[model samples]
Target: MAEYEAKFTELSGFVPEFVNTEEKKARRFQLATKSFISRNFSNKLNLNVVPLREVLQVEIANREIIPVNQVHHRCKLKLEGKAFEVDLIPFVLGKFNMVIEMDWLSSNGVQIDCKKKKVRIRVQDGKEIMFKGQRKTHKFLTMFQTKNLLKKGNESYLAYVMDTKKEIPDIQDIPVVNEFEDVFPKDLPGFPPDREI
Candidate 1:
């Protein structure tokens, strides 16, 4: 997916709210597709989305026509502090959570700045808001890459772990603790079984 995204020299990264829930989870929207939500995701979220009576035939890159039947009407999406209502069709898009098509963006007068990685959207009041894309610190290993590496059996892999907790300095290292070395000693004598500190 990263490889395909990199092929296009356009600004990427758009996340909008899909449903009204306590957690307020946001779904990723692909700029390429015709506004769609994954069928599995819809079911998992218990969106209770219903299928349209008329199935739409969607042509893919391979010239295959896929019938889309499910539609979630009037889905509220919040972007840059503004709310927009849109209808989303459910489809089986493997890694993609959802997609916001170019039609919606163009119709809404949204501007994309690839160089700056920003999206500009004009509200009803004619006020323009800029949303910046978060910079990627490192390229994440894709599922395909992981599968291939594991198949090789002798491949070297690196895992990156992030720690969010702030580290606290040792109590004995504090300036005030230096004045009370006897109370807070660097090395304390072992306490007896019944002794309490």
Candidate 2:
């Protein structure tokens, strides 16, 4: 393995200042969840198992930087009765960052809208599962399948995979607004059209 070194002829004082500011911005939020739950674990209802269905909608809360050697955006999640910590890591495809963006609606309420760019996390025997793209336009549909190559899983093969779109539909409906003709008198009579002097 070849080692490389960066040699700088001139070092600017502002370099440290700029780096400090960017670091602060990245580590703004911290995910905290253990404190909130006051219920006893012995109660069977409190330890209710969240149904690990093919797809589940979870409300995300407390958007904070997940400290994993480096700063990563993560959030507190609530799925049915269970509270979990989910890292906001997008599924990458080649050079594109096509992802399912999670947004916080209000007051620690984070919801995942699966209608656009669907994110499918298929569960197999409770532990093992695969994350897949459920939409046709998802760029990672093929890549996701290739990465998690399984002969047979609990999730149907045809359910998550989708065929690429053959052709883009032409723009059919476009909003057209008429120009205000009488806003200014159009070169009326002898008034030299309000010339900019």
Candidate 3:
């Protein structure tokens, strides 16, 4: 195998700088439940699937964020028992209102259509329930089928998987999955450009 030299360069781009501060504008975080997992291991409830046979009208603690200042807050759902952490990531979905999204580690995550003020989610074993457009997508970003939301329902229900959607949000890089290291690669060797071609 021929050895190859690696070199990297950036053509140019714009990055948001707050108050002329030289800080990376974004970070990633996560919320998982050891409690939710126990139910799957214990003597009865199968954690592999969330029982959605009769459960509907899911109560969620909505979250929202301000992009300019990069601030976040919960919807003040002072529910007694089981406090859930909602992820408020910055996204360019038309306006800045695409702030609060997805409840962490739930059977199905939540995505709110800011303009519609309606929530999008998925069920464990349930099918997709329509809400509006003639073309609707799947539950979450996983193995499931997609459909259209031609009708309106008070609370839309779905199965967990973003089976289809031509414009699904790119979310793979926003969540943390391993150890956190503060340092970045700054000492990588560069390759010389070939000038004798």
Best model number under lDDT? 1
Q: Which stretches of candidate 1 lie over 4 Å from their true place?
A: 1-33, 60-64, 135-145, 148-197
As for candidate 2, its clashing pairs are: 60-110
Tell me how many clashing residue pairs each candidate has: 0, 1, 6
Candidate 1: 10-residue stretch with minimal lDDT:
22-31
How many angstroms is residue 181 displaced in model 3 relative to the true structure, after the best TM-score fit? 87
Tens digit of lDDT per residue, candidate 2, span 21-82? 44454433321211112123213223332322233222232332222221123334543434
The prediction achieving the highest TM-score against the true structure is 1
Report, for every candidate in turn, its global Cα lDDT versus the true structure: 0.72, 0.34, 0.32
Tens-digit lDDT string for candidate 3 (152-185): 3334556597667556433343356222333323
Global fold similarity of model 2 (TM-score): 0.18
Candidate 1 residues 1-197, lDDT tens each?
88776753233323222222343212112224358888887788666577787777765545455877778988877877789977788887778888778888888899999999999998899999898999867567788878886887957757798676967668766788767867876676788479577
lDDT score of residue 137 within candidate 2: 75
RMSD list, candidates in order: 15.1, 20.6, 29.7
Which runs of model 3 end up more than 4 angstroms from their true locations?
Answer: 1-5, 9-73, 76-94, 102-130, 133-197
- lDDT measured at residue 103 in model 3 versus the true structure, 0 to 100: 38
- List the candidates' TM-scores in order: 0.50, 0.18, 0.20
